[model samples]
Target: MNYSATAPYVWDPNFADAPDCLLSADQCVIQAQHYFVKGLIEIPVIGSDEVFSWGVWVSLSRENFSRAADLWDTPGRESEKPYFGWLTTELTIYSPTTINLKTNLHTRPVGERPLIELEPTDHPLAVEQRVGITMDRVREIAESLLHGARSESG
Candidate 1:
């Protein structure tokens, strides 16, 4: 399940100049991105008006923090332990521009590329996925009603 809960702190630009801590543990909700005394990961779901990208950073645990540097220094092991590293994606929208990010957007599986299940190219979302305009696809469909440009190519 998507464990999406904001921490006790509120990072409203109107209220605080920076990310501010609000509630204590128990009362605190695990936020999407914010450092805490308690170990909490900040996953960045990045995307654009015409593109989408997703990433998650595991909040460093005390046990994991110390060894994090060593593990992090090692190459060819994005799926290793001690520190769960960052994963970046190049969003391409094309002849099939829109691409499907995996169910766990941030966590791409070990040693495999995320797959996109293509449906009939009809809805803006389907078209976007089919074409490859991802980040924008999520915003356009999930939150707002934006008409997207048609494309048979990326």
Candidate 2:
């Protein structure tokens, strides 16, 4: 399953016309203050080689965001160190919220989204990231997302 958020959770439509604000397929800057980048958070699917991914936005520090932008078109940019960020998408399937979780954005080769690694913790999302989830769980998630089941079983 792949889910994506078009903008950061803090984004507001009012800023869409602001000179200092910008939003693109993979990058964003709100009021030239909040910086964000799109990345993939992959969760392995058990009993198979498949993986579940979320095309999520993560807020990064200005310095890290600048560094990432500097290398955006540079080859071998994947060698850069991962940037610390906070999860800015709310995957409502999980309780206690999926926003503000600690994360490390690992830069990938050009043409690929960065990999988002959640901080190891007992949170359902983090737990699923550390340990693979069953196919049944994947189906449950799919149903919840597709059918608006509103189940928070994660």
Candidate 3:
């Protein structure tokens, strides 16, 4: 369940900011400078035979981020990567209050965590949920979204 073997992408939340919005409807922000480990992740799709490969975008508060960091640093966390838990939060986007972030820890219910699932791609949230990444090219789309939140915050 861990990606320690692959040295999965891990983010350093030094630059991540607290959840703060000037207006009621603002996107969630990453806060400070974060570092990415750059690796592949397998996303499971509910009720589907296919699994998606993508870079994981961990969106969480500094506290939760710290927890994730600690897990990543664990001696044999790679092979046990999928064990990384979840962090839940609500982010304001567009309107005063929008975007409910649910952590999809391996233990949680399907389609609830931040990682994307394919079976429900038709769902409105599916688009935001899917993020693809490969060894040759690490998709920055998710990171860009993380950055966008930063820009909107200021």
Question: In TM-score terms, which candidate is top?
Answer: 2
Q: Write the per-residue lDDT of candidate 1 for residues 1-154, one digit (tens) a residue.
A: 0122233223243433233433333122134243222222222234433334222222333444334334434545345422332111212322332223122212123333222232444744344444554444455443321122233232
Candidate 1 off by > 4 Å: 1-51, 79-154
Task: Summarize candidate 3's per-residue lDDT along 2-111 as a digit string, tens digits.
Answer: 11111112322442344431111111233343322222235444445545444333334455445445554354443333423222122222132212323343312222
- Give one clash count per candidate, in the order shown: 21, 0, 25
Instruction: Report the Cα RMSD per candidate.
Output: 13.6, 3.3, 12.3
Q: Candidate 3: which stretches are off by over 4 Å?
A: 1-29, 33-50, 76-101, 105-154
In the range 1-154, model 2's lDDT, one tens digit per residue, is 7888899999999989999999999999999999999999999998899999999999999999999999998899999999999999999889989999999999999999999999999999999999989999988988888766444343
Q: How many backbone clashes does candidate 2 have?
A: 0
* Ranking according to TM-score, highest score first: 2, 3, 1
TM-score of every candidate relative to the true structure: 0.25, 0.94, 0.29
Candidate with more favorable, higher TM-score: 2 or 3? 2
In order, the Cα lDDT scores of the candidates are: 0.31, 0.93, 0.33
**Window of ten residues with lowest summed lDDT in model 3:** 21-30
TM-score result, candidate 1: 0.25
